[model samples]
Target: MATETASREPRTKTRTTASPTVGAAVVKRTRTVAVRLTDAEEAAWIAAALVDGHRQLGAWVRERAVAGYLGKVRPKAGGGGLSPEDAAEVAALRQEMTKWGNNLNQVAKAINSGQVPPVMAEHLEKGWLNRCGQALARMADRLDALDDQG
Candidate 1:
Protein backbone atom coordinates (compact mmCIF):
# COMPACT_ATOMS: atom_id res chain seq x y z
CA MET A 1 0.00 0.00 0.00
CA ALA A 2 2.90 2.45 0.76
CA THR A 3 4.67 1.56 -2.53
CA GLU A 4 1.38 2.00 -4.44
CA THR A 5 0.87 5.45 -2.84
CA ALA A 6 4.37 6.48 -3.69
CA SER A 7 3.92 5.41 -7.35
CA ARG A 8 0.64 7.41 -7.57
CA GLU A 9 2.40 10.65 -6.31
CA PRO A 10 3.44 13.12 -8.99
CA ARG A 11 7.15 13.53 -9.83
CA THR A 12 8.70 17.06 -9.55
CA LYS A 13 10.52 18.50 -12.56
CA THR A 14 13.90 20.25 -12.20
CA ARG A 15 14.49 23.74 -13.57
CA THR A 16 17.07 24.23 -16.29
CA THR A 17 19.75 26.93 -15.93
CA ALA A 18 20.09 29.63 -18.61
CA SER A 19 23.25 29.78 -20.70
CA PRO A 20 25.80 32.52 -19.77
CA THR A 21 25.24 34.42 -23.02
CA VAL A 22 21.46 34.40 -22.52
CA GLY A 23 21.83 35.53 -18.91
CA ALA A 24 24.12 38.37 -19.95
CA ALA A 25 21.68 39.52 -22.65
CA VAL A 26 18.87 39.73 -20.09
CA VAL A 27 20.78 42.07 -17.74
CA LYS A 28 19.03 45.41 -17.10
CA ARG A 29 20.56 48.90 -17.21
CA THR A 30 21.63 49.71 -13.60
CA ARG A 31 23.93 52.73 -14.08
CA THR A 32 22.70 56.25 -13.22
CA VAL A 33 23.76 59.82 -14.04
CA ALA A 34 22.57 62.88 -12.11
CA VAL A 35 22.35 66.52 -13.12
CA ARG A 36 21.30 69.64 -11.21
CA LEU A 37 19.48 72.56 -12.76
CA THR A 38 17.98 75.77 -11.38
CA ASP A 39 14.22 76.22 -11.32
CA ALA A 40 14.17 78.36 -14.46
CA GLU A 41 16.57 75.99 -16.25
CA GLU A 42 14.51 72.95 -15.34
CA ALA A 43 11.35 74.64 -16.48
CA ALA A 44 13.01 75.60 -19.74
CA TRP A 45 14.24 72.07 -20.28
CA ILE A 46 10.76 70.69 -19.63
CA ALA A 47 9.28 73.09 -22.17
CA ALA A 48 11.87 72.17 -24.73
CA ALA A 49 11.26 68.49 -24.15
CA LEU A 50 7.54 68.99 -24.63
CA VAL A 51 8.16 70.98 -27.79
CA ASP A 52 10.33 68.14 -29.07
CA GLY A 53 7.37 65.77 -28.56
CA HIS A 54 8.92 63.83 -25.71
CA ARG A 55 6.61 62.63 -22.92
CA GLN A 56 9.45 62.47 -20.38
CA LEU A 57 12.12 65.07 -19.70
CA GLY A 58 14.66 62.42 -18.79
CA ALA A 59 14.17 60.60 -22.08
CA TRP A 60 14.46 63.85 -24.01
CA VAL A 61 17.67 64.79 -22.22
CA ARG A 62 19.14 61.31 -22.69
CA GLU A 63 18.39 61.27 -26.41
CA ARG A 64 19.86 64.73 -26.87
CA ALA A 65 22.97 63.88 -24.86
CA VAL A 66 23.58 60.70 -26.87
CA ALA A 67 22.95 62.50 -30.14
CA GLY A 68 25.32 65.32 -29.24
CA TYR A 69 28.03 62.87 -28.23
CA LEU A 70 27.61 60.86 -31.42
CA GLY A 71 27.70 64.05 -33.48
CA LYS A 72 31.02 64.97 -31.92
CA VAL A 73 32.50 61.49 -32.10
CA ARG A 74 31.19 60.20 -35.45
CA PRO A 75 29.83 63.15 -37.32
CA LYS A 76 27.79 62.73 -40.50
CA ALA A 77 29.27 63.13 -43.96
CA GLY A 78 30.73 66.59 -44.61
CA GLY A 79 31.80 66.41 -40.94
CA GLY A 80 28.50 67.90 -39.69
CA GLY A 81 29.81 71.21 -40.94
CA LEU A 82 27.37 71.33 -43.86
CA SER A 83 23.72 70.43 -44.34
CA PRO A 84 22.81 67.42 -46.49
CA GLU A 85 22.08 69.46 -49.57
CA ASP A 86 25.23 71.55 -49.11
CA ALA A 87 27.28 68.43 -48.57
CA ALA A 88 25.99 66.95 -51.79
CA GLU A 89 26.78 70.18 -53.61
CA VAL A 90 30.28 70.16 -52.17
CA ALA A 91 30.75 66.58 -53.35
CA ALA A 92 29.60 67.50 -56.83
CA LEU A 93 32.01 70.44 -56.79
CA ARG A 94 34.84 68.13 -55.77
CA GLN A 95 34.07 65.82 -58.66
CA GLU A 96 34.01 68.76 -61.01
CA MET A 97 37.35 69.94 -59.64
CA THR A 98 38.78 66.50 -60.21
CA LYS A 99 37.65 66.57 -63.83
CA TRP A 100 39.20 69.99 -64.25
CA GLY A 101 42.44 68.73 -62.75
CA ASN A 102 42.50 65.80 -65.13
CA ASN A 103 41.83 68.11 -68.02
CA LEU A 104 44.72 70.38 -66.93
CA ASN A 105 46.99 67.34 -66.62
CA GLN A 106 46.10 66.20 -70.13
CA VAL A 107 46.75 69.69 -71.49
CA ALA A 108 50.08 69.85 -69.69
CA LYS A 109 51.06 66.47 -71.06
CA ALA A 110 50.12 67.54 -74.56
CA ILE A 111 52.22 70.71 -74.26
CA ASN A 112 55.21 68.91 -72.75
CA SER A 113 55.13 66.20 -75.42
CA GLY A 114 54.93 68.84 -78.20
CA GLN A 115 51.63 67.33 -79.25
CA VAL A 116 49.95 70.79 -79.01
CA PRO A 117 51.09 74.00 -80.74
CA PRO A 118 52.13 76.90 -78.50
CA VAL A 119 49.11 78.97 -79.53
CA MET A 120 46.71 76.10 -78.82
CA ALA A 121 48.34 75.44 -75.44
CA GLU A 122 48.00 79.10 -74.52
CA HIS A 123 44.33 79.03 -75.56
CA LEU A 124 43.72 75.90 -73.49
CA GLU A 125 45.42 77.45 -70.47
CA LYS A 126 43.32 80.61 -70.77
CA GLY A 127 40.13 78.56 -71.15
CA TRP A 128 40.89 76.47 -68.05
CA LEU A 129 41.73 79.63 -66.04
CA ASN A 130 38.41 81.19 -66.99
CA ARG A 131 36.58 78.02 -66.10
CA CYS A 132 38.35 77.86 -62.73
CA GLY A 133 37.45 81.50 -61.96
CA GLN A 134 33.82 80.87 -62.86
CA ALA A 135 33.75 77.75 -60.70
CA LEU A 136 35.21 79.71 -57.79
CA ALA A 137 32.58 82.43 -58.19
CA ARG A 138 29.80 79.82 -58.25
CA MET A 139 31.21 78.17 -55.13
CA ALA A 140 31.40 81.53 -53.36
CA ASP A 141 27.78 82.21 -54.28
CA ARG A 142 26.70 78.84 -52.93
CA LEU A 143 28.64 79.46 -49.72
CA ASP A 144 26.92 82.81 -49.38
CA ALA A 145 23.56 81.15 -49.84
CA LEU A 146 24.40 78.59 -47.16
CA ASP A 147 25.49 81.38 -44.83
CA ASP A 148 22.23 83.16 -45.44
CA GLN A 149 20.30 80.01 -44.60
CA GLY A 150 22.32 79.59 -41.42
Candidate 2:
Protein backbone atom coordinates (compact mmCIF):
# COMPACT_ATOMS: atom_id res chain seq x y z
CA MET A 1 0.00 0.00 0.00
CA ALA A 2 1.21 3.58 -0.90
CA THR A 3 0.84 6.54 1.56
CA GLU A 4 -0.66 9.85 0.39
CA THR A 5 0.03 13.34 1.78
CA ALA A 6 -2.63 16.07 2.17
CA SER A 7 -1.70 19.57 1.16
CA ARG A 8 -2.73 22.60 3.33
CA GLU A 9 -2.62 26.34 2.73
CA PRO A 10 -1.53 29.00 5.25
CA ARG A 11 -4.38 30.93 6.89
CA THR A 12 -4.34 34.66 6.98
CA LYS A 13 -5.62 36.75 9.93
CA THR A 14 -8.86 38.73 9.55
CA ARG A 15 -9.72 41.83 11.50
CA THR A 16 -13.15 43.09 12.57
CA THR A 17 -14.52 45.93 14.65
CA ALA A 18 -16.06 45.12 18.02
CA SER A 19 -18.44 48.00 18.19
CA PRO A 20 -21.26 47.85 20.77
CA THR A 21 -23.85 49.46 18.59
CA VAL A 22 -25.37 47.01 16.14
CA GLY A 23 -25.35 47.95 12.45
CA ALA A 24 -23.32 51.03 13.28
CA ALA A 25 -19.76 51.20 12.08
CA VAL A 26 -17.31 54.02 12.33
CA VAL A 27 -15.68 54.87 9.02
CA LYS A 28 -12.56 56.95 8.59
CA ARG A 29 -12.69 59.83 6.14
CA THR A 30 -9.29 59.52 4.47
CA ARG A 31 -9.95 60.96 1.05
CA THR A 32 -9.44 64.64 0.39
CA VAL A 33 -11.46 66.55 -2.20
CA ALA A 34 -10.41 70.02 -3.19
CA VAL A 35 -13.13 72.53 -3.94
CA ARG A 36 -12.69 75.88 -5.57
CA LEU A 37 -14.94 78.71 -4.44
CA THR A 38 -15.11 82.36 -5.34
CA ASP A 39 -14.91 84.97 -2.60
CA ALA A 40 -18.67 85.45 -2.59
CA GLU A 41 -19.30 81.72 -2.60
CA GLU A 42 -16.90 81.16 0.28
CA ALA A 43 -18.48 83.99 2.23
CA ALA A 44 -21.92 82.54 1.72
CA TRP A 45 -20.80 79.10 2.87
CA ILE A 46 -19.03 80.59 5.87
CA ALA A 47 -22.13 82.51 6.87
CA ALA A 48 -24.24 79.38 6.61
CA ALA A 49 -21.70 77.45 8.64
CA LEU A 50 -21.69 80.14 11.31
CA VAL A 51 -25.47 80.04 11.56
CA ASP A 52 -25.21 76.30 12.10
CA GLY A 53 -22.52 76.96 14.76
CA HIS A 54 -19.90 75.00 12.87
CA ARG A 55 -16.41 76.28 13.70
CA GLN A 56 -14.73 74.25 10.98
CA LEU A 57 -15.80 74.99 7.42
CA GLY A 58 -14.23 71.79 6.09
CA ALA A 59 -16.17 69.62 8.54
CA TRP A 60 -19.36 71.50 7.72
CA VAL A 61 -18.75 71.04 4.01
CA ARG A 62 -18.09 67.34 4.43
CA GLU A 63 -21.28 66.91 6.48
CA ARG A 64 -23.31 68.85 3.94
CA ALA A 65 -21.86 66.88 1.04
CA VAL A 66 -22.52 63.54 2.70
CA ALA A 67 -26.05 64.53 3.67
CA GLY A 68 -26.77 65.70 0.14
CA TYR A 69 -25.35 62.51 -1.30
CA LEU A 70 -27.53 60.40 1.00
CA GLY A 71 -30.57 62.58 0.28
CA LYS A 72 -30.93 63.35 3.99
CA VAL A 73 -31.32 66.69 5.72
CA ARG A 74 -28.26 67.97 7.50
CA PRO A 75 -28.93 68.20 11.22
CA LYS A 76 -27.69 71.06 13.36
CA ALA A 77 -24.31 70.82 15.03
CA GLY A 78 -24.80 69.36 18.52
CA GLY A 79 -21.80 70.04 20.73
CA GLY A 80 -21.41 73.60 22.09
CA GLY A 81 -24.46 74.72 20.13
CA LEU A 82 -27.66 76.12 21.61
CA SER A 83 -31.09 74.74 20.96
CA PRO A 84 -33.65 76.74 18.99
CA GLU A 85 -35.48 77.92 22.10
CA ASP A 86 -32.28 78.97 23.81
CA ALA A 87 -31.17 80.83 20.68
CA ALA A 88 -34.44 82.67 20.52
CA GLU A 89 -34.17 83.60 24.18
CA VAL A 90 -30.63 84.84 23.66
CA ALA A 91 -31.74 87.03 20.73
CA ALA A 92 -34.55 88.56 22.74
CA LEU A 93 -32.24 89.16 25.66
CA ARG A 94 -29.68 90.85 23.38
CA GLN A 95 -32.34 93.15 21.95
CA GLU A 96 -33.63 93.99 25.39
CA MET A 97 -30.08 94.74 26.60
CA THR A 98 -29.47 96.99 23.61
CA LYS A 99 -32.51 99.02 24.40
CA TRP A 100 -31.50 99.28 28.05
CA GLY A 101 -27.98 100.38 27.04
CA ASN A 102 -29.35 103.08 24.77
CA ASN A 103 -31.62 104.37 27.53
CA LEU A 104 -28.69 104.45 29.97
CA ASN A 105 -26.54 106.34 27.46
CA GLN A 106 -29.25 108.92 26.90
CA VAL A 107 -29.66 109.35 30.63
CA ALA A 108 -25.90 109.78 31.08
CA LYS A 109 -25.74 112.34 28.30
CA ALA A 110 -28.58 114.31 29.85
CA ILE A 111 -26.98 114.21 33.29
CA ASN A 112 -23.64 115.42 31.89
CA SER A 113 -25.47 118.24 30.16
CA GLY A 114 -26.87 119.32 33.59
CA GLN A 115 -30.46 118.30 32.75
CA VAL A 116 -32.42 115.37 34.14
CA PRO A 117 -34.33 113.32 31.55
CA PRO A 118 -38.04 113.14 32.42
CA VAL A 119 -38.14 109.39 31.73
CA MET A 120 -35.24 108.79 34.07
CA ALA A 121 -36.88 110.90 36.77
CA GLU A 122 -40.15 109.05 36.29
CA HIS A 123 -38.40 105.64 36.39
CA LEU A 124 -36.63 106.67 39.57
CA GLU A 125 -39.81 107.87 41.29
CA LYS A 126 -41.86 104.80 40.28
CA GLY A 127 -39.11 102.46 41.52
CA TRP A 128 -38.87 101.13 37.94
CA LEU A 129 -35.10 101.49 38.05
CA ASN A 130 -34.90 98.87 40.78
CA ARG A 131 -37.04 96.54 38.70
CA CYS A 132 -34.81 97.12 35.72
CA GLY A 133 -31.75 96.37 37.81
CA GLN A 134 -33.29 93.13 38.97
CA ALA A 135 -34.15 92.19 35.40
CA LEU A 136 -30.59 92.91 34.29
CA ALA A 137 -29.20 90.78 37.10
CA ARG A 138 -31.45 87.90 36.09
CA MET A 139 -30.42 88.26 32.49
CA ALA A 140 -26.78 88.28 33.52
CA ASP A 141 -27.26 85.03 35.42
CA ARG A 142 -28.98 83.41 32.48
CA LEU A 143 -26.28 84.58 30.11
CA ASP A 144 -23.60 83.24 32.42
CA ALA A 145 -25.31 79.86 32.44
CA LEU A 146 -25.59 79.89 28.66
CA ASP A 147 -21.93 80.84 28.33
CA ASP A 148 -20.95 77.95 30.56
CA GLN A 149 -22.92 75.58 28.36
CA GLY A 150 -21.22 76.94 25.27
Candidate 3:
Protein backbone atom coordinates (compact mmCIF):
# COMPACT_ATOMS: atom_id res chain seq x y z
CA MET A 1 0.00 0.00 0.00
CA ALA A 2 1.26 3.54 -0.86
CA THR A 3 1.49 5.93 2.17
CA GLU A 4 0.95 9.69 1.77
CA THR A 5 3.79 11.87 3.31
CA ALA A 6 2.92 15.28 4.88
CA SER A 7 4.67 18.42 3.48
CA ARG A 8 7.68 19.37 5.64
CA GLU A 9 7.76 22.91 7.03
CA PRO A 10 10.75 25.14 6.25
CA ARG A 11 13.72 23.79 8.23
CA THR A 12 15.52 26.26 10.54
CA LYS A 13 18.56 24.10 11.13
CA THR A 14 21.84 25.93 11.73
CA ARG A 15 25.08 24.84 10.00
CA THR A 16 27.35 22.88 12.37
CA THR A 17 30.31 22.37 10.07
CA ALA A 18 33.59 21.17 11.56
CA SER A 19 35.70 23.87 9.84
CA PRO A 20 34.98 27.61 10.23
CA THR A 21 35.10 29.92 7.17
CA VAL A 22 37.46 32.35 8.98
CA GLY A 23 40.13 31.88 11.64
CA ALA A 24 39.17 32.58 15.31
CA ALA A 25 42.17 34.92 15.88
CA VAL A 26 41.31 37.12 12.92
CA VAL A 27 37.65 37.34 13.91
CA LYS A 28 38.36 38.70 17.42
CA ARG A 29 41.49 40.74 16.69
CA THR A 30 40.16 44.29 16.82
CA ARG A 31 38.25 45.28 19.95
CA THR A 32 36.71 48.69 20.52
CA VAL A 33 37.28 50.05 23.98
CA ALA A 34 34.66 52.35 25.51
CA VAL A 35 35.67 55.32 27.60
CA ARG A 36 33.67 57.61 29.82
CA LEU A 37 33.26 61.06 28.31
CA THR A 38 32.03 64.38 29.61
CA ASP A 39 28.76 65.34 28.00
CA ALA A 40 29.92 68.86 27.11
CA GLU A 41 33.39 68.01 25.75
CA GLU A 42 32.65 64.66 24.12
CA ALA A 43 31.31 66.28 20.96
CA ALA A 44 34.40 68.42 20.56
CA TRP A 45 36.80 65.50 21.03
CA ILE A 46 34.89 63.32 18.59
CA ALA A 47 34.69 66.16 16.09
CA ALA A 48 38.47 66.53 16.28
CA ALA A 49 38.93 62.81 15.67
CA LEU A 50 36.53 62.88 12.73
CA VAL A 51 38.19 65.96 11.21
CA ASP A 52 41.64 64.38 11.44
CA GLY A 53 40.33 61.03 10.16
CA HIS A 54 41.15 59.47 13.55
CA ARG A 55 44.89 59.76 12.93
CA GLN A 56 47.63 61.21 15.21
CA LEU A 57 45.42 62.69 17.94
CA GLY A 58 47.90 61.52 20.59
CA ALA A 59 50.81 63.07 18.69
CA TRP A 60 48.95 66.34 18.29
CA VAL A 61 48.17 66.51 22.01
CA ARG A 62 51.76 65.58 22.91
CA GLU A 63 53.19 68.30 20.67
CA ARG A 64 50.86 70.88 22.18
CA ALA A 65 51.78 69.79 25.72
CA VAL A 66 55.48 69.96 24.91
CA ALA A 67 55.14 73.41 23.37
CA GLY A 68 53.29 74.62 26.49
CA TYR A 69 56.00 73.15 28.72
CA LEU A 70 58.75 74.81 26.68
CA GLY A 71 56.89 78.08 26.85
CA LYS A 72 57.17 77.90 30.63
CA VAL A 73 60.94 77.27 30.53
CA ARG A 74 63.28 80.21 31.17
CA PRO A 75 64.97 81.60 28.06
CA LYS A 76 68.73 81.08 27.80
CA ALA A 77 71.13 84.05 27.78
CA GLY A 78 70.87 84.54 24.01
CA GLY A 79 67.66 82.52 23.49
CA GLY A 80 66.79 80.17 20.54
CA GLY A 81 69.55 78.80 18.24
CA LEU A 82 73.03 80.27 18.52
CA SER A 83 74.43 82.73 15.96
CA PRO A 84 77.61 81.80 14.00
CA GLU A 85 79.68 84.26 16.02
CA ASP A 86 78.30 82.90 19.28
CA ALA A 87 79.10 79.31 18.25
CA ALA A 88 82.64 80.36 17.28
CA GLU A 89 83.05 82.09 20.65
CA VAL A 90 81.86 78.97 22.47
CA ALA A 91 84.33 76.82 20.51
CA ALA A 92 87.18 79.17 21.37
CA LEU A 93 86.19 79.15 25.04
CA ARG A 94 86.12 75.34 25.04
CA GLN A 95 89.67 75.22 23.59
CA GLU A 96 90.90 77.73 26.15
CA MET A 97 89.28 75.72 28.98
CA THR A 98 90.85 72.51 27.75
CA LYS A 99 94.31 74.14 27.69
CA TRP A 100 93.79 75.53 31.20
CA GLY A 101 92.66 72.09 32.44
CA ASN A 102 95.82 70.43 31.00
CA ASN A 103 98.01 73.10 32.59
CA LEU A 104 96.21 72.64 35.93
CA ASN A 105 96.63 68.82 35.81
CA GLN A 106 100.39 69.08 35.09
CA VAL A 107 100.86 71.65 37.81
CA ALA A 108 98.91 69.41 40.21
CA LYS A 109 101.20 66.47 39.39
CA ALA A 110 104.31 68.65 39.82
CA ILE A 111 103.08 69.89 43.18
CA ASN A 112 102.13 66.39 44.31
CA SER A 113 105.54 64.93 43.27
CA GLY A 114 107.31 67.50 45.56
CA GLN A 115 110.25 67.78 43.12
CA VAL A 116 109.50 71.29 41.75
CA PRO A 117 111.04 74.32 43.53
CA PRO A 118 108.81 75.81 46.27
CA VAL A 119 108.73 79.22 44.49
CA MET A 120 107.40 77.79 41.23
CA ALA A 121 104.90 75.65 43.17
CA GLU A 122 103.64 78.71 45.09
CA HIS A 123 103.17 80.76 41.91
CA LEU A 124 101.26 77.89 40.14
CA GLU A 125 99.10 77.35 43.21
CA LYS A 126 98.31 81.08 43.37
CA GLY A 127 97.25 81.22 39.71
CA TRP A 128 95.06 78.09 39.90
CA LEU A 129 93.49 79.25 43.16
CA ASN A 130 92.52 82.57 41.47
CA ARG A 131 90.84 80.74 38.55
CA CYS A 132 88.98 78.51 41.01
CA GLY A 133 87.88 81.61 42.88
CA GLN A 134 86.55 83.16 39.68
CA ALA A 135 84.64 79.99 38.73
CA LEU A 136 83.10 79.77 42.20
CA ALA A 137 82.07 83.43 41.99
CA ARG A 138 80.25 82.78 38.72
CA MET A 139 78.47 79.76 40.25
CA ALA A 140 77.46 81.92 43.21
CA ASP A 141 76.03 84.50 40.83
CA ARG A 142 73.95 81.86 39.07
CA LEU A 143 72.67 80.56 42.38
CA ASP A 144 71.77 84.10 43.41
CA ALA A 145 69.62 84.43 40.30
CA LEU A 146 67.78 81.24 41.22
CA ASP A 147 67.26 82.54 44.72
CA ASP A 148 65.92 85.75 43.32
CA GLN A 149 63.47 83.81 41.16
CA GLY A 150 62.21 81.95 44.20
TM-score of every prediction relative to native: 0.35, 0.46, 0.33
Clash number by candidate, in order = 0, 0, 0
Candidate 1 has a TM-score of 0.35
Q: Model 2, poorest ten-residue lDDT window?
A: 11-20
Evaluate model 3: give its TM-score.
Answer: 0.33
RMSD of each candidate relative to the true structure: 23.8, 21.5, 28.6
On the 0 to 100 scale, the lDDT of residue 119 in model 1 is: 72
The whole-model C-alpha lDDT of candidate 3 against the native structure comes to 0.46
lDDT of each: 0.57, 0.64, 0.46
Candidates 1 and 3 compared: the better one by lDDT is: 1
Q: Which 10 consecutive residues of model 3 have the lowest summed lDDT?
A: 25-34
lDDT tens string, model 2, 1-150? 223333353224322342124466754433445676764565556656645677567767767877789976665666537655565556566657777778768877877998887777887689866777887888889978876776
Model 2 misses residue 6 by how many Å?
A: 84
- Please write out the lDDT profile of model 3 over residues 48-99, one tens digit for every residue: 4323333243433434445588864323332333333433333344345556
- Better-scoring candidate (TM-score), 1 or 2: 2
lDDT of 2 at 18: 24
* Model 2 bad stretches (over 4 Å): 1-51, 54-80
119 Cα displacement, candidate 2 (Å): 4.4
